[model samples]
Target: MAKEYTVTPWEVHGDVDYNEIVKEFGTKEIDDSLLKKIEKYGKLHHFLRRKHFFAHRDLDIILKDYDKGKKFYLYTGRSPSGPIHLGHMIPWMFTKWLQDTFDAPLLFQIPDEEKFLFKNNLTMEESEKWATDNILDIIALGFDHKKTSIFKNTEYAKTMYPVAVEISKRITLSKAKAVFGYTNETNIGSIFYTAMQSVPAFLPSIREGEPTNCLIPYAIDQDPHFRITRDVAPKLGYPKPASINCKFLPSLKGDSKMSSSINETCIYAGDSPEEVSSKIRKYAFSGGRDTLKEHRKKGGNPNIDVAYQWLTYFEEDDKKLEQVYHAYKSGELLSGELKEICIETINKFLSTHQKARAKAESKVEKFMLRD
Candidate 1:
């Protein structure tokens, strides 16, 4: 039997069964028909082609609206408790594709207050500091400054609070508890945080003075939060927000998603080449046989190899990736060779990213959303 897994807004554990998750979450799997429709708008992003983004809710309705010349905005967020890691960037990369393909505006929310309330050791000041640090990396992803509006919850409270109160009015305590697993011991601020999260989904509609569609591209762990947003949208006189959820990018240890709390397993945006190389070679799990001779005879299993898994996210060329996959499986490439490839690819990507990140420091104000 499969080991029991837990996936929630606060934690992820075990080897997550994605297929089982799709079933449990009641979300539709993305099929060939949907791929064709998306490819019609723009080259379907490689993440979609690779099935990294695997499921959806009300996506068809968003496409239908686009066909009818109605526009939808994109919404996604970061909770600022720590530094941003590679795993956190996966969905944002896909979100950028959605913005470009559909010519949509984006509202990038930094919910520092939520982290402050939920994290026992975190203070509001530290959360706020991390919020600024995170914004630089978000800008480094090259979101359009004119079209993208990034804001922190505390900084934008004047605008966000009124809408949150309106949304909270529509949600009952029992409903929030049932959805979020809030206990009697749970702080009241955490209970009310969901209402703040729901506000961005409808902000576009409120701003335009007419109902507008919004698309949230997020990790599947976040499905529960958006489930609440979809429920409250219409009652607040807005269109239900649509969403597409993706799987977690596994950690170097291959147990669960890459977590910032696990320093050795994560590759942060600011990590130097030396730090990245050491982490991959030292801690990345291997799928090789016990001996080199055995590996040569029976071959390595790229299926569970952490290096190969991380390669899938960075390597854009389909043919190149398949060649590496085949070579590793045939023992033509060694486990060390696979790690070298992942290391080189990531370092190359980050070398360019670090330069952009430095430039991003001066440009934060241009993209910030202000009341």
Candidate 2:
């Protein structure tokens, strides 16, 4: 029997089976043929080559349009409920590559209102503050301000509210409840939030007064919202937005996606090098044998080892990654040594990122779009 797991926008736990998710969500797997086709347009980023972005919907169609001289823009966003974590960086990093490769315009949405309404403990003020902080991290990734437009929901309400109303009318309460698992106790704002989320996918097409293709790079958990959006797109006379979905970056504790709720399991972008080192050493779950003799005889299982698993995302060089994988599997590398490598890699990345984030303090206005 297959392992049982749960994956939702608000919650992710258990041993996630990506194949099951793709099948259940009714999305097509990104096959080798698609990767070759993508390479013809622009350099295939390592993420695509490695299948980190493993599943997609209508990607081939979007590329088909691109080949025929029809250009498509990109849309991806963050819900600023807390500080940005390393897991949060995964999609954005890949999105940045897409922007560069395609030379496409990007709209980064900060759905502060959605987050504030959904999380009881989060105040509007807090969500806005987090939104500002989150934007800084996004900017640090070096998105072109000239081609990128960032906006918080509340700030862009005048533009979005009218579109949202049109969507809300099309989606019935029954549909919303089924898609989002909403209960009668669920807030009115929360039910209405999906419509707001759907607006960006169709917003560009409406503004241009032409059918504009849109590609959304997101995690698999966010599929339901877009499923609703895809259904309503034809009704609104817009081309359905296409999306590429990535697997979750696992938590340090193992078998779970990294989340902000568990501070120990997550590595925040703002975390100090010392903190990164400390967390990996103290908490990252290991897949090594208990004793040295046993470890040498049995070898480490990289499949369950958090440190080795993380390297798959962080280490871009395939040759280097293979060396590490084999070294650990043969017990030539100890668990502590593997953790040290991860510590060094993450700390090095964050050290440079922190500097960019600090510099981003002044550049925020360049990316923000509003009245």
Candidate 3:
């Protein structure tokens, strides 16, 4: 039986079966044929080669439109509730590759309001602070300011609210309830939020005063919101937005959440080497045998090892990653040894990233989209 799992905009957990998700969500799998087509434009990103971004809705159409000399833009965003973690970066990194590869403009939305409405204790001001913090990390990823427009939903309300109003008109209460599983007690703000999420898909067309194609690169949990966006696009004289969806990065604790407050559950992009080391050594689930003798004889299971799984997301050197995988499976690398490599890799990445984030502080105004 497939493992019990859930994928919603607010929550993602369990041993998610992507194949089942694609079937249930009515999305097309990102097959080799699609990969080959994408590879022709430029070198295929590892997210595609590794199949981390494994499902799509009309991705082929986006490419075909590009070939016909009708350009498309990219749209993706974050709901800034807390510190950005490694799991959150999975789709952003892929979205960065998409922006670079296509030379396309990006509508990067930071929907601060979503979190405030969803989290009872999180105030609007707190969410806005997190949005600013999240934007710095996103900028650190090297997304071009010229091609990227980052906006917090509240600050961009003048432009977004009117568009959201149009979208809200078409989506009935029953549709919202059915799509999101909303209950009687679900707040008015939360119910109306999907329309706000849908606004960016129509932004380009409205801005250019012409029909525009949009491609959204996002994680699978965010797919339901886009399903509604795509449904309403055609009626509004815009092409349905195409999307490529990625899998979540697993927690250090294995099948669980990466709460920002818990150092052991997830690795924040801003974490220091000591914190990273502690988390990996103390919490990262191991696939090795319990005893040294048993480990040497039976070897390790790299497939289930949390440290090795993280490498699949962050370790870009294909040959080196393969070496580590085989070394662990053959017992040449013990669980501690594998965790050490992971710790080193993450710390190296963050050292460079933190410096870039610091520099991004001066460049925020250049990227922000406002009145």
Looking at candidate 1, the ten consecutive residues that score lowest on lDDT are 1-10
Off by over 4 Å in 3: 1-3
Write one digit per residue (lDDT tens) for candidate 2, span 1-371. Answer: 86578887787888889988999999999999989999996778777877889999999999899888899999999999999998999999999998998889999999999878888899999998999889999999989999999999999999999999999999999999999999989999999999999999999999999999999999999999999999999999999999999999989898568989899999999999899999999999999989999888889999899998888888888898888899999998999999998898888889889999999989999999985
| Candidate 3 lDDT score relative to the true structure | 0.89
Model 2 CA lDDT for position 215: 98
Q: Estimate each model's TM-score.
A: 0.98, 0.98, 0.97
What tens-digit string does per-residue lDDT give for candidate 3 at 13-112? Answer: 7778899999999999999999999998898887788898999999998898899998888999989978888888888888888888888999999998
Clashes of each: 0, 0, 0
TM-score of 3: 0.97
The local distance difference test score of model 2 is 0.92
Error of 2 at 218 (Å): 0.4
RMSD of each: 1.1, 1.2, 1.3
Candidate 1: tens digits of C-alpha lDDT, residues 155-244: 899999999999999999999988889899999999999999988998888889999999999999999888898899879889999899
